[model samples]
Target: MSKAADNIRFVIIMAATLFVMSLGALRLMKLQLVDGSSYLQKSLSSNTAEQVINAPRGEIADSSGEYLVSNKAGFNAVIQKAFFPTDNREINRIILKVANVLEEENVSWEDALPISENAPFEFLPDRESDIARLRKNIGVQVYGTAEECIIAMTGLYETDPQLTDREKRIIAGVRYTMYLRDFSVSNRYTFAEDITMEAVVRLKELTYELDGVDIVQEAVREVKTGDVIPHLIGTVGAISAEEYDQLKGSGYALNDTLGKGGIEKAMESTLRGKKGVRTLEIQGGAVVNDEITEEAVPGNTIKLTVDSDYQRKVQTILENHIYWLNNQTSSKAKGTEANAGALVVLDARSGALLAGATAPTYDLKDYLENYSKVANGENSPLLNRVTSGLYRPGSTFKTVTATAALNEGIISPTDVVNCQKYYTYWEGWSPECTGYHGRLNVVGALRESCNIFFYEVGRVMGIDRITEYASKYGLGEEMGLETGRGVKTGYIASPDTFEARQQVWQAGNVIQAAIGQSDTYVTPLQMADQALMIGNRGVRYQTYMVDSVYTYNMEELVSKTEPTVAAVIEDKTGHTFDKVIEGMEEAAAFKAYTYPTVKEYYTDSYLLTELPKKAAIKTGTPQMTSKSDTGSAFIGFYPADDPDIAFSGFVEKGEYSKLMIRELIEAYYNKDYHIEKLGGRTEEELAAALSDNEDTDSFDEDNEDLED
Candidate 1:
């Protein structure tokens, strides 16, 4: 009985075992037949990466729709962190090989390391910040020398000793740059940008050996009219660590290009389009599937109020006049030291900047290629003199004083003041005038730029009244501009300005201030805005450069900048500005006989006689200090009876600021001088044309004579 029971149990166990084996066989068959491809894909796949597809930055155009800045297709050599070699030695080897290839092709790569490439290592003199960052990055002390830092970096990167010092330095530079960019599985590094197709093809040939390397096609910022408006249409550069830290939360990548100054920086958000995502599936070191997960939206186009061709013409005129001034041999020609200046034109009614020209300027493309030479060049070519340079308003401030005196009831149109060529108002202070006119009214005073007349008037109006009027005219106030920040708000000659400088404000200062001489400084833009206000009869519009913004393809209008009234000076007396306008007009129309020696240089005492339309103008010679030469300044508006445009110009150590007026007015009136429509051509065609014209210097012929 026991043997029979044991046999039954054994049979049951055998049956259960067979049933389990049959279930396993069925499961294996299902997996092989139904899910085989999916499993096989999972086994062979190396990575599934989500890459950022950079969007094209916006194009910038003038009000007439001429391209000022645009984008051209270019290639960049980049390295994906996920696919880059993991081993340190292998990484160094790949970098060394890539560097050699670039060197052989005479192409440059990004190398921010401050150390010298050769064995006699030394820290770059101008890269103080970079050296400090490098020292901090390598766990070296601030006191560590360049040699010590290089040795430490060599060991830190685990570079092979068999490599030459130069080879190691090259690899170190790339490694350090990658580290600074925070190279990780989530971020890629840009090795070099704006590379040639030949280099791209060469790189592609070594794709299998160059792990993680890629050639990305992108839109490079091209300055179509770089020479026309470089200061306003700014520059674009690689994203710095500081910029990245501030922008990372706003979808900015570790590797990104950003605006450095001017319009580019001001409209960064508007110009930086949303980046798209591309999901890449890699298998056996090759992409098996590629899909664009998100489509990129290109940046909007910014249209400025400036006319590019008019601006170019203005620049040429300014350059030519400056050159002529510096080359004059006559003793009567006094501005031999004239080396730099600025001129600004604005629509008198709207305050729209028509043109702004800064002398000693440089082309944007040349500035990028030869940064050191241009940056360190004489006369400060990079300085935006129109907005940043501060100079005493000189006699130009007399207009403000005259306005204050007239508006405050201190003076009248026919009120006469005797001029003995000296104002002995205070006990110890006596300011001299250019000539002794026996008796003159407000019109005669302005026409002659009579200092004694204004001094007496200013003494009666007082400093407080002068300051008030100056503020109303936008002097010592911020002129709202669409271009980027760093505009200077120069102060009026007042007790407050003296106090800020920790100097005592004497009672006699008001007389000097009345003539625009005491501690008063103003920008060319401010001067232009003031002229606009005067032209508009006390109404001041907010000065602006951008007219509107449009969609990437320029099919849709995003926003328009209207002519907004910023401030208004009400004439309580109804005809308060009548006499002031009369004075400016008289000044513009004044004529004086000249000696033969200087007649050719100064055709008329007032230089606006040849202008097609009547102009209300004022000229000033500001003496900054006892040691510095006087600077020439002029402010005016055309068609005195019906003002249209206002202009202000300043020339450092220059004589006649009015010399450029007639030519500028002619350029503006002649519609044929406007830049041709660049919208008809595609971006590629425009870029090609610009490239072909790169060697065509805009001011070369005009400046050749002034090169001494």
Candidate 2:
């Protein structure tokens, strides 16, 4: 009975086993023949990624084809999300280790978290937007304190509780940066840029511990002629969150760098070349094959109108004259507070800026390293005074007065105006002149700079006619420069400007405005443009800084700037500007013969009894206040009979603006002046100099009480 049951059980068990085996074989055959290829394609696609290969940024050069800014190969530390650990604690550990390595090698990494590094954490000043972003990302209230946000970030990122506040802060910063960059398989986060080889080597040693970290080679901005024109060339830095949001649709990655200021920013579209793509195949958390699917295109090269050598000479002249003025002990020298100034030279016929120099300037590298110190330094070294500085034109405004008087037939060029040493035109306002010239015509008045003559003429023409002439000559107007923003459109001293300040425009204000006082303020660039218009007699041209743009290798031209007419002065009397030109010529002759200060400063070899070419020049000593020293200003055009170049200079609280005239003329006529070159001040030197220059005499351009 047991044998029969065992036999029956064996037969049933064999039959069941055979049926299960047949079903398993059929399923394996279907999977192997039909679904295998689909699953294999899915596995391959999941591991493959497309990476952006950034193109090299364009280079910048002066008009003479000398490189001002270029690019060099550098290494960057990157973190790939596909290979990173998913655990929060592991991510924190890896970031802290990488930060330690960077600190040891004296390398800087991107840590833009708004909280302070120490325990008594406070939000940094002027980082409202960043702080707001941090708060939102961490799910904190908008009004939450820095400490509260830090605590929230610490908890959210699962930072190590045993770590110090500083270590926790480091971890939080990297994690937040990752979040801001949208770090994922498609987008890699850049941990550090332009790192030293030492840092790269150290980071590589910890490759096993730092799972996601990798080294990448990229092109970094290399400043070649930073000292000559730092303010104009500007700088490049990491793209901000706001910038990323605006540029993301344009195929810009969060890790991309862009121009931060000046020409670099103005020409960003041309300088930032198109990006390329690289397709990578990953297997076992390692990149197995990488192929370039698209090739990167380098940016265009920009050619500026400025000649580097001439620019350097101009910078030296301004710096030297400013230095001399600051050290003067004579009572006649009122430049003890003259710590800053600007000088500009332009081609009178074309309005091409040949040279522009702003003193109390800084190096670009120093600015990139310690932006706060440079930005907030004494005298505002970051300020491009040539285009941004607003100063009283003083006697320089008389040019507009004479033009108005003659054009409107209020007074002829031969008509005489009495000078009583004071303009008693109004009862309470009696603005005095430098001396009592008794009576003088237009040419004589300009030669002697008689405030009384201009005051009488300005009162006759009224403020409307005066403003019309001033606008024609580009006074108190925009220069229409091709450079970046910050070009101020200063206003003329009229009822409109006074009304803008919510003040009454008194009748006597016209007398002051006639002499370049009251509310009239202008930049040195505008002054040069005025001189250029005077040289051209009636026509004014739009000024430009960029000359042309070319391909990356400069083999093909992209674009070129052409001279364009901006304005033409309308004259009822065709001989209006004739008298103004004669007056300026006589004024230059008067200075050459009577002014001994310029002759005393130059050696006999450099000095001359007469200029190489006749110049039409005028000087101004605009008073800031009764207590404050006056500002020195001068404008001129060379070869008065056949004007070639026009120039202007202004020194704060200086009384010797004429001293620069002779030297500038010499530089323009001779090529030797551009031979000598000098390097810019170092960061340490700049800091020490700024500290020593404490009496900056800050002047608020918008202050209502600032009267000349």
Candidate 3:
């Protein structure tokens, strides 16, 4: 070939080769400079697998370091919606298995397998006979295939008349659940009520044996003494829609649990540990590579100010009194409802709430599963009456007025006053006493709960003095206790009530105020605090349920409860609390000033005289303003002179305060015999009250006290 042609062909080939080399070099430079680290990380991720690690939950203890609530491990039967079957027969079989297991274990099926009008499916027990029986009745054969079970577990109940559409969807999505695990047992031999470690192991074994089945360790709560402290400890539930919307991206997931009531609600932030995230690479909705994007910091440990023995005593007292109250008030006022009472015991010196009890309270284990039943029941069993209930203080409030009168120099201890049957001031208003006890001193008035004596003293002191004294006595305010539940600050008459009463604040209104009427509503906690103040000679302490918060590492976030003087009656205040206390002591003994004719009632009939331990006791009966009966209440402390603990108890719609006082006294003195004494009443007397006649315009003088 010609030299020119050969040169042209060679030039074309070399030019093409050089151009390719230049392009390759530029591509190498871009990769090295622009995305080198990104590719390297991707490569490393493909080789190295990440895992999620869960932090240990914190422990819980009571005042004496006894276990009241705690955490444990258990198995959860979770069905990922993706893997679950949509068939009804499979669902029935699975439910039968669950139900059988629960029944065989002797766990109460009231909650776990509840028959709900709004739920399409029912939970199953793990027993062959039960499953076969259910299958026969439903005409659904149980092959026990994993696919069949998954289909039934995830089935949509289109035909089930009881279930709502939303409920069906929710049930379908919530395919898996961990068991309610507890460590404490009734006795060492028998299995504990809660899900056991053995069950968890069995679940793991089941997962290994079955394909498309898996198990994960999930935290479960174990209320160490749940039955004893149901009202005080409370339970947790899923966050509401509003809570979810507000907490979105605030680190709370849609499935996060929120505090529903009691200590759980009160100390939510401290008890609910900081949640962490586990990001997994999922294939067909199944996790393959699990990586803990964030670490979970377990919740802080909460130490309560509760005493187990004291709590038991309060329960015993309440149960015993239920019978006598029903008998005495059934005909007169229709008596209290079946589940209508609450009691609280507090350490008068430290504001440490020792025992809190509420009647007709549903078990915490059953509460979540049967929420509707609890909420819509005739009696609100889930209500924490001790902290949330508000009522007229009745005679217990007289302590406040007495303290005020003594401070105001309105009346001296030795000053004698005559009490007529009743007092009449203006038109259409007559404040009457139950009986006339002539020539009685302040101490005597307190013992008999005399309305006239306090009326006179209150008239001298007036409303301003009453309010001031009430404040000093820790009324009309929130007692900062650890329960975090919303406690009513308690309503006191504003300036307007007094300003409106300026012309009328003289004898009658003041008299009404002296009796705990005239715009006064208080919580049981307040009553207990006042009693404690009197028990401790007017030294008020900051009440706290939680002694401290600690980390898993045992680092204390909060210190132990410190005793604080809430208020003190100073010399300049013109009050000597000792005088009021002296009256209270005599009244507690039921022997303040006995008139010749007023001694018909035997001394043995009085509760204070028969108490095992000396207690300064007071009873109160407030007029009700609703369908509920007048509230009955009692406040006292053991070893009255120098007391270690003080308590106050109230029963809603209770007709007579004396009966409750007797029950409390008897329970303290004769522990085993108290219930028997109260149980003498028949079933007819125990029926719930019918109606309450209340007039807000008129005042009931029986409820007032000078102790505020």
The root-mean-square deviation over C-alpha atoms between each candidate and the true structure, in angstroms, is 11.0, 7.4, 14.5
- Please identify which of the two predictions, 2 or 3, would achieve the higher lDDT against the true structure: 2
Candidate 2's displacement at residue 281, Å, is 4.0
Q: Write the per-residue lDDT of candidate 3 for residues 1-708, one digit (tens) a residue.
A: 999999999999999999999999888878887787766665555332232333444566776667677777754443333333447545433434443443454443222211121334333434455345334433456654323333353443332435444334333322222111110111001111244455545545554333333345566666667656777677766554466678766655444566677778777767777766555564533445657788888887877777666567666566655544444321222343434777877776687887777775666656655766876776777677777787778777788888777666677778888888676545687677757778888777777778777777776777788878787777777788766556666765545556655633444556676778766777888888888888877787766787777775346666555777777756444345566666666767653232111111112344466666666777777665752446677777767878777778787765434445555444444535434323544554333221222322223343332222
Ranking by lDDT: 1, 2, 3
Q: Model 2, range 494-609, lDDT digits (tens) per residue? A: 99999999989988888889988899988999999998888888888889988999999688999999998989887669888788988888877662232222222333323222
Model 1 regions lying over 4 Å from their true place: 1-48, 282-288, 595-607, 672-708
Candidate 1 vs candidate 3, lDDT winner: 1
- Model 1, 1-708: lDDT tens digits are 699999999999999999999999988988898887778877786878787888899999998898889989889889987678889999998888878888888789988788887878999888887788889989999989888987897899899888888988898899998887777655678898888778888999999999989898888778877787788888888788778889999988767788899999999999998888888887776667789999999999999999877887888777756665665544444577889999999998899999999988999988878888999989999999999999998888888998888787888778999999778766676777776676998888887888889889988889999999999999989899977487889898787789889999988888888888889989999999988888888999989999999999688999998898988998866666777777788877764433222333323422576676678988888886753578889888887877888999999887777767776777788956543333345767545432321122232332211100
List TM-scores for all candidates, in order. 0.87, 0.87, 0.67
Global lDDT scores for all candidate models: 0.81, 0.81, 0.60
Candidate 3 TM-score versus the reference: 0.67
RMSD of 2: 7.4
Q: Find the 10 residues in a row with the least total lDDT in model 2.
A: 699-708
Report the lDDT of model 3 for residue 193.
27
Please estimate how well model 3 matches the true structure, expressed as its whole-model Cα lDDT.
0.60
Candidate 2's displacement at residue 586, Å, is 1.5
